[model samples]
Target chain A: MTTAIGQYQYDQVDRDFLAARIEEFSEQVARRLDGALTEDEFKPLRLMNGLYLQLHAYMLRVAVPYGTLNAAQVRAFADVARRYDRGYGHFTTRQNIQFNWIRLEDTPDILRLLADVDMHALQTSGNCIRNVTSDEFAGAAADELVDPRVHAEILRQWSTLHPEFTFLPRKFKIAISGSPNDRVAARFHDIGVIARPGDDGRVVFQIFVGGGLGRTPIVGQELYDSVPEERLLATLEAIIRVYNAHGRRDNIYKARIKILVQALGVAAYRNEVEAELAQMDIARYRLSPEMVASIEARFAAPDLQAPEGAAAVLAEQRAQNMVFDRWVRSNTHAHRSEGHIIAVVSLKPPGEIPGDVTADQLDRLAGLSERFAYGELRTTHLQNVVFGHVRQDQLYDLWRGLVDVGLGAPNVGLIGDIVACPGLDYCALANARSIPIAQKLGARFADMTLQEQIGALQINISGCINACGHHHAGHIGLLGVDKRGEEFFQMTLGGRADDQATVGKILGPALPEDDTVDAIARIVDRYLQERSGQESFLETLKRVGEAPFKEAAYDTV
Target chain B: MKRAVRVGAGEGLVITANRLLDGAIVWLSADHTWQTAIQRAEVLVSDAVSERLEGVQSRAQADGVVGIYEIAVRPEVGGPVPLTMRERIRAFGPTVHPQFAYEQQEGAGA
Candidate 1:
């Protein structure tokens, strides 16, 4: 039970799989370089391998499965950043890390390095069931019913190189949460699965289908209230099969399963899935209990037996250092194990790109994770890192170390911690630059005291309707639009991505680029002034409605 | 004199595309070659914009250069300034990473 889960150890078969693909891609790349394969011919081949020609350069998106990474894997990422890319890598909204400045020739080597580390870029992009994401704290969270990663891993294995679903209507996303609290934004994914313990103590799945955010953002409708553990695969198959058969293929905009589910009312869609399931042999997809148990056994719980008086020591440190106290308050979460906490290392330092980590910083984080976090780290959907099993006694030391490495911002869920997509600056599909706006907002909310006072606000920014930043799910969402080719921003209020996931309502007319930060400040001010007692910004918005925020936002001087 | 080479005309456009090999920001040059330095851009008048851009696109298609388009630019003291903020950033590189910002290639000129 205590075996180290140093990434799903890629056996010889996995290695061979990657090796063959790598060889094939290398040849393709060479041919393309030597004027053999045309751009049209080479594009699909490159995209299948997780390569994209972005605004400036060829970007390589790597699959960091369920956002879990060991020290060595991280170091390899750092190496890739330094060697192949522009000294940095961006941890994307999907929990995958993308190198923005990858050269086409260097991609094979990068994939080789990733393969060596039991990591590969397969299904990170293109029309496939993409890198399966789950709760960053799946195994470690106190309220977890079951580790979602166990099933996530199962799905990863089942979906990897699957022949049938490779060329779907659009790229598919699946998310699993072990806990009721949806930390991975499960409601916004194409397939959302919740693992809950049954009365008999066996794990069951509650499945949601067609949940996605893009040109058309919609919360996934629940397809199955509770699917037996054995029926999970069959159930998922039925859902995907229905989607594949009926999903719009001619129109790229209307291709997602969310649109399909919406077009056919939930009941009708469910009926289709049910019909599909009825025709299928469910037993063939059913996993034996022993198979499930073996996967579960591999996810060994970290040794959390800290030295006695660890809590006392943490309290003493908190008492001695106000800064440390602020950090613990903002950045740490309760762990299932005693004397341990899930420590979030904020990537959103003031005026920095939300998820950009320098190679040097990544190397340092890798070392720190090895030293303090059981050689394991998890990248959150919020674009931050979580040390799942950091001892309370060593919290202060870890904080100090993180601060030295420029990863400590002490504003995990606060306004300063913004979630932004790489907009026009990097993305080809963007209308405005998200990073600068995030930088401006971060700077405006640089006051730690003010950020702490504001408390637990999710601010998400997207360059376009394709809400890669999950702006539709933000407490305060900023969508960048091109108003006659000039950058303008639309603000939305009251949206959230929890169990009660709601898409934000647009507040009034879109504001000019220059007016964005000021409007945000004004909105925050309204929330602060109008809120009753300890009601959060979202709570206040829900209670008093968006009128106050709208008024404050529109009241131009 | 030589018609004063009107700098701020509506079609004072530059053919810009990402390089085929590395996806670097490149512009069509007077010599019918691609240059990484936007300073070396060959601006075309209104009549030539479409034909020149089309020709450039065709030439670059096999080279793997993508998203070729004519970007409007106004002549500044030193070089042509891209009209939109999008093109400006693309011409100069990301504002966030100043170290990796587009630098003048050794032999390129305005």
Candidate 2:
């Protein structure tokens, strides 16, 4: 018999807890079923897991699918606020949003409302499936072998309350990545899928299951061979079903699929998955060609005419304006089209918390999207906003407008583009304040001249290993740890954000809060001093290794 | 410093469960005062004074001086009334615990 993907499954005792919760919710629902409990009485239950209702009393839990939202999605969120909520929605660090002012009596009506717009809170708070997340740059980046979004979306549809998979022991989280360069923090997810091309020209996924970073941090085990595209959804269903049957249920923490994967050796897990796939009625649940076609059609890039003389225009801008040229080089990337460029709005400003877009800024971005870019937005896992289609001709205008709003910092891929979460200030789970640490580091690297010299570097910070800020994927990752009730910061070097993704190694002991920024500066200065010309930060780190930087970062301190 | 008070649009009303303790709907008035809008089916005085409301207790604690309550309010009838709060702290929105009132009590000690 094949073992489960993760060794831990809910036992009979765990089922008792799940049943108790269901009963509790059922009682609460019954009390308000016929409008008995007023709005005030029903709010606490919703807020516990970041859920809210919108206009017409429809419930909407902002999916924090890893705290990455694009300018368009951010704007669309504001639109959702205006249209559905009362022009205001609360942001949660789980990378989700919630509108608290909803009518509980109209929950089903709201679910229907979301379904009308191809959106639903389907397993948002339930024990069933949840939103499948991937690196926001899945398709657009120059380094990816294949877009992981197609796979993520495919999995998303398949797992939306699949009858057999819904009543699992506990919540499950899945993250996918094509960027081996480390865009998505794959190591800390229940099931982390990394897309790689095999020697046979087939797209293979290196499956890491049962890895998570909460109270217990463990790296996932690989449990699959090159799972082909056609069999991806079916394979995932089998894995979930296996976990549903075998995952631990006694303790909530142990119920995660990660524990199950850990308990079962990778070989055993793989064997189980293979056996389960073999026994399944694949045709019944397999994504049909027509369904795939319809979904792909919706995600298809919008048609646009290529602006003639785009190259010459960029060349002229570069020759005359160094600032504009630097921005274009760092912040803009070549689109599949001849004249269009995808622009990333780096949320990392020196001393600014990543992924926070103020209400006013949200409005301005909405206006900009309608004007320059086709009203499409994408949020990157690196905690930045992206405009998918921007014409080269409109680049200067967009940049100038963005500069007016204090968003035209050309540090998109540079050292200054830090990803940080709202730590102790807002998060009930955080042990230390992450925003201040990120702010301090951002201030240290605020100089545009210094940033240009360092080139593209991602510095991610997490208040805790829930990894909300994606600290595991950064080229230079900083994690906030609590020591004897005191806040301390740890630094990791050589992490990357591209297709050949590798988690950074820890550089000796953790630093005190006071010396954290300077320690980072020392590391950067060391790279500047020792690196050969044209060598990026990751390349320099790999070539010279973390020894030199570690010596510089800690020895003097 | 003068705090700015504006009539922002009435976002949806948030009704929580605690206000329904003993099956009564509790609410605060616009003037930062505790008052019962409804109690036990019958209209006990067409307009009851804020003081006569049931379970409206005030105290000076280590945190600050504030009122703790389990009062009820209904719109026109003795049912769940969705009253919109403006510039009122304690009754700003529907919350999980009616006990957790939003008061400027933090600055009261200061």
Residue-level lDDT for B15 in candidate 1: 80
Docking model 1 quality class:
medium
Q: Model 2 reproduces what portion of true contacts?
A: 0.00
Q: Could you give candidate 2's per-residue lDDT for residues A370-443 as a string of tens digits?
A: 67765545556565667767788788888887887777888987888877765544443555667777777788
- Residue A331's lDDT in candidate 2: 89
User: Model 1 segments beyond 4 Å from truth?
Assistant: A1-6, B1-9, B61-64, B104-110
Clashes of each: 0, 51
Expressed as tens digits, the lDDT of each residue in A1-557 for candidate 1 is: 12355245555887898899999999999998887888889999999999999988999999999999988889999999988997998999989999999888889999999888878888988888999998988688898888888889889988887787999999999999989888877788999999999988888888888898888989988988889888888888888989899999999999999999999988999999889988999789897798887777656567678888888999999999999899999998889987888899999999999999999999999898978899899998889998988899999999999999888898999999999999989998899889999999999999999999998899999999989988999999999998766899998887898899999998878899999999999999988999889889988988998888899998888
- Candidate 2 segments exceeding 4 Å error: A1-49, A52-61, A64-76, A79-128, A138-151, A177-182, A185-188, A194-208, A211-222, A298-300, A497-499, A543-545, A555-557, B1-110
lDDT of 1: 0.87
Clashing residue pairs in candidate 1 (N, C-alpha, C atoms within 3 angstroms): none
Alpha-carbon error at A525 in model 2, in Å? 2.2
Report the CAPRI category for model 2: incorrect
Report chain A TM-scores, every model.
Answer: 0.98, 0.79
